[model samples]
Target: MTIACILVILPFCLALAAFSDLFTMTIPNRISAILLAAFIVVAPLAGFGMGEISLHIAAAAVVFVVCFCLFAASVMGGGDAKLLTASAVWFGLDASLVDFLVYVSIFGGLLTLAVLLLRRQENAILASGIPVPQLLLTAKKIPYGIAIAMGGFAAYPSSPLMEAAFRATFVTTA
Candidate 1:
């Protein structure tokens, strides 16, 4: 069950947010809400001590503050902020958290460049009917949720929750 949570829930939420943002330029609030709620429930069952859970909460709180500031500055969308904060809880305050953020930054930069290129060729793309998400070419903002999801995926394997869940699910008792 823990394994399923680690594997299925997070990935599903990320993918949904990514696709939604890709199409609509907005991530539904429910995805972030579900992520934080599921982590709160599953972290304990996965054997995270109170101290560890507190750190995870603390990590999310810190991310919330930063994301809030970014949103306030109009540097990021509110949905992106919420989703990033929720995702941070899975990594807690550790190297995996850093890795997740790093991957987000890297993917964000690449995604930005790609979006700019796509927008530049928007007229040709529309003429060719290459079947890209319309918002991808028309929207002024980048769908940052895609980068967040990509980062979540890249860093998920090393997250403490997954590391422990893996041990619980796969390590032989003998």
Candidate 2:
């Protein structure tokens, strides 16, 4: 039951952040809060040891510091920083964290290019009958939460927390 809840919560929150950013160009603070709170509550229940949990917290702290600097410089939005930090907690200080960062950077760059191209064609899109979100067409900021969410989902399957959950669910006594 706990594993099921853990699996559901993280993906659900990631999806929410992506969709919210797609529609509004903003990731609600509540989504980041839920992610951080859920990690705090579920990591232990999922049988993570103190050392592992501490590593996860450390990873989140490092991510938060870097993201905070980015936000301070106006290179990224505050909500994107919070979401990235919270999501980093699941990866811990391991190869998975590196994977998440790499995926985020790649996806973020691709998303930026796509958005820039779309913005270049905004007039044609507006003239067409197809409807698009106004924020997507007009906002100068890229909806980076979508890229972050994509990176989160991409890295989640290999994350320590998910590995622990898989073991708890599948490992059985003979």
Candidate 3:
């Protein structure tokens, strides 16, 4: 029970840290290291056993390779790639890479929309003779940890909830 709780909470907290870093365009190594360490500890406990664990590790490796390639092409940040790979360690094979990528795309779209709207507002203010910062010129890059965190949050813990409910239902029979 305690392990389950830790597994659930730690990722959520790390997601928040990631979000903050993404917002500020800074990926704090401390937070990234902590997340990686947590996965190293928690993966074995997730009970897929050794072969399954290897598969999960492979999934993470794939994520690393794919995302790193994107980063190298200048399509994504290195931090985002590392964070996604670390997230894959926890996600495992049950969660398809396609779905993970979908979640990221959806979240990225939302973030882009929000920033665009904010930029528009800034433009309007400047046009109306109101003092405003040059948002287009001075806007900091979105850290992207926010989107990764969102994906991780969506991927986590609903499985455990379902498992618990299923166990309760079969308790008397078992």
Cα-based lDDT for every prediction: 0.95, 0.92, 0.64
Using TM-score as the measure, the top candidate is 1
Q: Write the per-residue lDDT of candidate 2 for residues 1-174, one digit (tens) a residue.
A: 778877888889999999999999999999999999999999989998899899999999999999999999999999999999999998999999999999999999999999999889999999995688989989889999999999988999999888988888788521
lDDT of 1 by residue, 60-154 (tens): 99999999999999999999999999999999999999999999999999999999999999999999989999989988999999999999999
Error of 3 at 21 (Å): 2.5
TM-score of 3: 0.74
How do all the candidates rank in terms of TM-score, highest first?
1, 2, 3
Q: Write the per-residue lDDT of candidate 3 for residues 1-174, one digit (tens) a residue.
A: 535544565466556666556446656666666666775665455444677667767887888888889998998887777777876766666645556666777887887777667665875666787653353325655556777777666656443322343454467368
The 10-residue segment of model 1 with minimum total lDDT is 165-174
Q: Could you tell me which residue pairs clash in candidate 1? A: none
Candidate 2 clashes: the total is 0
Candidate 2: minimum summed lDDT over ten consecutive residues — where?
A: 165-174
lDDT of 3: 0.64
Judge candidate 1 at residue 126 and give its lDDT: 94
